[model samples]
Target: MESWLYILCICLILGAAIGFMAGLLGIGGGLIAVPALLHILPQVGVSAEKIPHVAIATSLAAIILTSLSSARAHHKRANIPWPLFKSMLPGFVLGALCSGYISEMIAAKSLQQIFAVFVILMAAQMAFPFKAQSNRDMPSAAHLFIAATVIAVIAALMGIGGGVLLVPFLTWCGLQMRFAVGFSAATGLLIALFGSIGYTLAGWDAAGLPDWTLGYIYLPALVGIVSTSMLMAPIGAKAATTLPTAKLKKIFALFLTLVGLKLVFA
Candidate 1:
């Protein structure tokens, strides 16, 4: 097959898979897309050294679209917490701005390594079913502020949608998994919106970026990913409602473990 054709096909498949997984996992889709893009982008002409930054930036950009779609769908289900959303936005904005600057300073490989370790740890935590929930009776405004701060810090540092932290935190705050997932998707949308803007503006002065690139994001990848992920994520969300999540958690953990090792050694 021609290289362009092959790349096109792979990009489409990745978009569908990431979208589906995002809906199923209530993640920002960055965790999956970043790692996969790191592997795939080089073949499509991006320099290997820049692939990780591009992956992270583009994943964030794509999430803006995918998360909006996912959140809207979940909104119809009445799963998002509007009060909490209001409380968190301010912190998210600050964190995103700071993180974008930090991202521009870091090497792509370093970011990938850091993210891999974080994923492995988070996966391990998820696999174990902690059975502990955070206290929620406290003032809603206070907790929302705290949660948003934590999310912004993590999202910027980890270069992931805030969903990974938000979902678990919300679940710990006593929301059911389904509601937590939906709300987290909504939060992810917010993070993406602010984070992408921050990264783009911060990296505006960055040099040697490609034609399809904006700051750190690669436009082609964003379009390919967002379009397909939006269409397919609901499928994953539907399956998540009916599936044995514990088993899926175990599998996802194993996958992350392997990917972490591969990234570390590569």
Candidate 2:
């Protein structure tokens, strides 16, 4: 036996690093975690045929915990925009729930390619950093619903918290960065929660699943990642002020690009 214990060790290391980077760079850990899990899960005996769906579901499960913590902290600050949050919930929930089923329908290779593309796009956004304002208030309820739905679907598909899309959209709608971030944190909770559940349901009766899996969500990986990410997020936040994020972001972005390419062609 190759000792599945190494999987836990790998998860802890991945979690700790992600927590530090999240704190250090303010990016969601999912972007990193999805790729990391894809690499690590096989060590624990997950089949390559199921790796993509498994990675995504497990990442979303991890996000449920992380996003909840972030949402709570942001909520304490009283910065979350409740009205917007309320309006978007219907669409967000719907999209997230559908993601698991949708993912199950797709091939693992296709999913990996999508994730790879998504990762590259996210890296580009973060690394390059662009902001444009339309000088308008939030859109109509219908528009908001539609936009939220799109974002939520993608977030579920990518196993991310949707902050990459949400934060910028909120900021563009005239919300300050701080408020936008807080709002996005709250929203991430919704995405993670429903998204993970959908995955669980989607994978409930899956074939050849590992011993500790709940649908596509890998239990050991989730435990290790959630435990460490929570502990390190604050540390990352503290270090953010002192780090040369500009340079770091560029380097990390390049790294993500390579990772994305590897996933696509691997």
Q: What C-alpha lDDT does candidate 2 achieve relative to the native structure? A: 0.88
Candidate 1 on 100-166: residue-level lDDT in tens? 7777677877877888888777777767755445556534776778768778766756657776677
Error of 2 at 149 (Å): 1.2
Worst 10 residues of 2 by lDDT: 1-10
The TM-score leader among the candidates is 2
The lDDT, on a scale of 0 to 1, for candidate 1 is 0.74
Count: clashes, candidate 1: 0
Query: lDDT tens digits, residues 208-248, model 2?
Result: 67898999898888888988988998998898898898899
Model 2 residue 207 CA deviation (Å) reads 0.8
Candidate 2 steric clashes: 2
Clashing pairs in 2: 23-236, 23-237
Model 1 misplacement above 4 A: 1-8, 24-28, 44-49, 134-136, 139-147, 171-182, 238-245
| Candidate 1 weakest lDDT stretch, 10 residues | 130-139
